[model samples]
Target: MTTYLLKSGILLFIFYLIYRLWLENEKMFLFNRIYLLASLVFSLLIPLQLISFEPSATSKIISVQLDELAIQKNSQSFKSLAESLDLTNIILAIYVTVFLVLIIRFLLNLFSLYNKVLRSEVQFVKGEKIILINEPILPHSFWNAIFINKQEFKNDRIPSELIAHEKAHLDQKHTLDILFIEFLQIIFWFNPLVILYKRAIKLNHEFLADAVVNNQFREVTKYQSLLLEIASNKTNIILASNINYLITKKRFIMMTKKESPARIFLKVCSIGIITSLLLFVFSCKDNPEESNTKKQNKIEKSSVGIEEKSTLPDEDDTVRSLAGLEIKPEFPGGIEEFYKFVGKNYQAPEEEGLKGKVYITFIVEKDGSLSDFKVLRDIGYGTGEEAVRVLKLSPNWLPGTINNKPVRTLYSLPITIQSPD
Candidate 1:
């Protein structure tokens, strides 16, 4: 999840740079709006894509055996190698916590708006429902209802041009755009670019609405003046379409600027760059499929403690395992005899503690020796140390092979230590 968010942030930064440089002043509001939304979608989806590369038959396959390594993880020290697996869970918990907080905030805004609508006096003007609030509010549109302050409505201070501008928002269904971006913000709350995306989309909606209203008036200067007056006493709601001072200067400039078709070409070029980057990231050679389950019944032996085996790549093409081989590794007698050796030598810590499972992962070297002993998870009280102690003293077994040749294989084992019930 951390890797995914990093990739998404990088892509969003690149997309935002492209927009600022080539599309911001182009008078292409609709295209820019789609481009911004699409960039967010692509950032989220691109990291999920995967492509596999097949190795050539003659490619050099170096099966390096992991050296004798013991990783100790206990209550005092978390710097152990096993934390590589635990870090994902830690990051996921944090991400979910922030996401839920943002989701609650978003819902509260929607509820506040709904409550205001319910309390306000409502009437239809030319088949459109308008709401008059008792408090000060700059004329803004939410869905089909237009909201304005009671003073503005009673004193006829509301301009027809402003109503027409908000009507354009309703006709174009801009609220859906706001809601979509807000939803994304809830999920990717940690990402700064998601916040920028919401701002960009809102500004673009204003551009589209301004374009519609400017066309209805003979003199555009008059409408621009009215926009300035509205901005002077504006009460902007994030979820509502209202006149905003931050974006007003840009909107005024965009209203008079001539449309540029070349900017559309730039939009295409930006999308192409995004696609190329995504492909490069997703199809990278090291994107491995994860496996968490232990492989069973792979240990079988002959009288001499050497069992021949044919091996193939694992399902994810990331690791070679005993299960993927035609003939697997074994102990002197078989798997039953191997477990008997562990059962006798393995000692549970007498210290009273939680009854749980300890996960161990080790590499079966090409020389049929167990090395790289990792104490993945433990309940402490010296139990993890004891498991490592017994494994390091065990006898050598048959190694796994691929295509009738000896190859290093990885194995995972779970040793459950039960307490007296």
Candidate 2:
């Protein structure tokens, strides 16, 4: 999960950098909108390894190996890793708590908007439904509803241009985009790039709406003056698309700027190239030659002292990593049962208040027998040996297989031992 988040976060940063450097200032509101949304989607999906690309013949593929079975000690006999309040668990707890708070805040905002819409008077202007609230807030749009001050409407102070701007937001369904990014922000509250993405997305929305209103009215100076006036009054509801969002100098400049087709085409091509590079870096897999080389290296590294036991034929001596297997090995019942067996059977060391982990690696042979046991790390007082003893007594695992044939696969287990006070 950490690795996935890191990869996705990096992708998002790169995509956002591209937008800021190449597309942010351009007068391509629709294209920029599509690019921002698509950037978020691709940043998420690309890291999941859902899209696989064949490595080119000339491309160098790097293979990273990880433990097949990384079971944490969380059975009844021992204190669960999470219950110990380790740093990882604490961080996870904080993240989840913040995420829930953000979710609740988002719901409250939606409810407030809904409550206001229900209580205020509704009117139709130029074939659009407008919510007239008895407050001195700037005009904004949420989903299908446009919100404005009831006093402004009664005094005929709300301009048609303002109504048109909010209408553009409603017609384009900008609320959905805002809601989408809001949900993303809730999930990735820790990621700074998500904040940047929300800001960029909202700013682009303003650009899009401004372009529409300017084109409709064909009076850029008048619209800019109205935007300045609206900017003075603030809207507290973030979920709503306000007409006065980020009324910056750039927004005013983008109103009158013109972009050439060639410039847009070139920038888009650059983005495509960058995206391709990211995909190749994160999603491409090793080719057949590289796979065989990695398998050979893994077998050589794991084959240290093989016990002469009644086993499979000599031709089946090739040991493979658990990841390359078609069907991975499993404990007698399941992984959880195996953890229970280890926790129940293993005896902690007699050290006073000892707290550390024992790292053990062993190979599950083709004949479903364990062999090549190695104690990679051991705290003092025979903790590693005790872990090995418990594992040796474990029932034979269902050997991992490739193409319906059983193969030896290496497994690594780390057991945490915390002596009681």
Among these predicted structures, which one has the highest TM-score?
Answer: 2
lDDT of 2 by residue, 66-184 (tens): 22222223334444533443666788899989989998999899899989988999988768888999988888899998999999889999898888888999999999999999999
What lDDT is obtained when candidate 1 is compared to the true structure? Answer: 0.67
Name every residue pair that clashes in candidate 1.
none
TM-score of 2: 0.76
The positional error of residue 188 in candidate 1, measured at the CA in angstroms, is: 1.4
In model 1, the worst 10-residue window by lDDT is: 294-303
lDDT of 1 by residue, 60-178 (tens): 12222121122222222212223543776798899889988988888899998899889989988898889999988788888888888888888998888888988888999989989
After superposition, the stretches of candidate 1 with alpha carbons farther than 4 Å from their true spots are 50-96, 266-270, 273-277, 280-421
Cα deviation at 34, candidate 2, in Å, is 1.0
Which lDDT value does model 2 have at 32? Answer: 91
| Candidate 2 off by > 4 Å | 54-89, 286-360, 365-369, 374-390, 398-408, 413-421
- Top candidate on lDDT is 2
